[model samples]
Target: MKRVFIIAVAIVTLLVSAEAQKQKVGIVLSGGGALGFGHIGVLQALEDNGIYPTIVAGTSMGALVGAMYANGLRPQDIFDLVKAEEFDKISKIITPSGLRRGSMGISDHKNILDMLDKYIPANDFDSLKMPLYVCVSNISKSQGEIIHSGGRLHEYLLASSSIPLVFEAVELDSMYYVDGGVFNNLPAQAIRDKCTYLIGSNVNPEKYRSPIKSGKDVAMRSVSILIYENTKPGIEMCDFMVDVPVNYFYSPMDFKHFYEIYQIGYKAGLDYIKEHPEIVRKCKGKRPDW
Candidate 1:
């Protein structure tokens, strides 16, 4: 009788452990150019609370941050990289005259790609520390493309962030690809099937106020409007959402205010975690190995 009771207790413990392991958590990051820095802060908050994602999906700037994080970079590591002077040089826009004649825009896409190659340790999907889904706008198909495997990881990351008319499109397998924001700025749906729970970080401003100023403002506001409309479905999919507070003044091209933007995201993340303790409880089941 004693032996049977011990065996039953051991079996129950094993079943509980297996159930915990089965809970897969995913985080979806949205595209917001320079504002994407905020995602790092949110990631840090999640890490601090012992919550780690089993999968990560992102579009545009979100793709850059999410890929780096999923590739084993800590939030602080990414923050330090972006705050350095080297990143400024890499992210700089080429002068119009320096651009190839009749090119789409002034950004030197090669510089960003080179930076990614140097920083990201993995060259392909099979080696990534965790599963990552990068979203890109497929110009040939006129839709969003979710890249989970194949090809160089850095190149795909660049393709996901290649802002139309600002940076040249990336050609892979004869298909032209650009910023995923053009289609799905918030791509929670890409990883919905892969995880049982979802968390999302949105840095795009809810709405642009009046008194639109420069051409840059117009461009930012126009894109923000589209992101606002498109993000609704993705927002609905998230079990927990961290809406990073940002305004129209935060230009996508501006990389100078890293601390400010990151802090905002961190606060928002902490606030959400505090308000929804259940999310933390659910996520505690699976901690990232890295």
Candidate 2:
């Protein structure tokens, strides 16, 4: 039943995202969840890019990390505990904490998180208000927004479909501090000062305006836009990410071959969510708070 529900949710969410691109380019955006910390840089970069894109940040604890914990991999704790290629321990964490992990709100304290959160001061986000202090989570989704990642992931899929991209906040899910608190989306306060229903947090109408918001999760109202088809006339365009590389996708970000690394990451993200439909279909589940 759960698997079937998840697949159905995945199909619907992807379909909706696929369908939203009405203009020259259809853009979807999201930040680090499946991965961690670096996603923030990606978001800030998007913000810095003159184009104002709709930003939808999710809570790391609720839909994003909670789901992972429920599934057992303890995804939020990945950074602090496993410093390097510790895939074995990672896989093990998921197995024990999965929905099948038993128990209620929290499954096992003995499970690495307790020790990691307790002994390791790095994972906690109290009083740190720095650039990446809101590290509690990588992706954003609270009790209500299960489709956050899927929605953001959809943006990348659009690029893969070759729809003539203007700008996309690519592979943002695996880039931020997943286990910390995030009030700083003070990375907060929209720079555009004022925006429309679709515009995001960092958008600046006087600039490379985008209808995306950087801190929320609701989808945009369907409207006509000549976005990706062609960069609007007079709109100075730039693709800073071109040479940026795929290293961001594979943490400890390798400066070696930037674009190539991110290129791989970009594709991997698309393939991952698409291949694992069950994982994405979330919202419908009974949450702990409820």
TM-scores of the candidates are 0.85, 0.25
- Candidate 1 structure lDDT: 0.80
Worst 10 residues of 2 by lDDT: 126-135
Q: Report the C-alpha lDDT of model 2 over 237-277, residue by residue, as the tens digit.
A: 21111111222233221323323433343344334335544
* Clash number for each model: 0, 66
Give me the candidate number with maximum lDDT. 1
- Cα deviation at 85, candidate 1, in Å, is 5.6
**TM match of model 1 to true structure:** 0.85
Runs in model 2 deviating more than 4 A are 1-58, 61-90, 97-124, 127-290
Q: Give the Cα-based TM-score of candidate 2 against the true structure.
A: 0.25
What is the C-alpha RMSD, rounded to one decimal, of candidate 1? 5.2
lDDT of 1 by residue, 178-269 (tens): 99888888898888866789999998848434357788668767777887787778899998888887554466766777778888889888
Q: What local distance difference test score does each model get?
A: 0.80, 0.26
Check candidate 1 and list the clashing pairs.
none
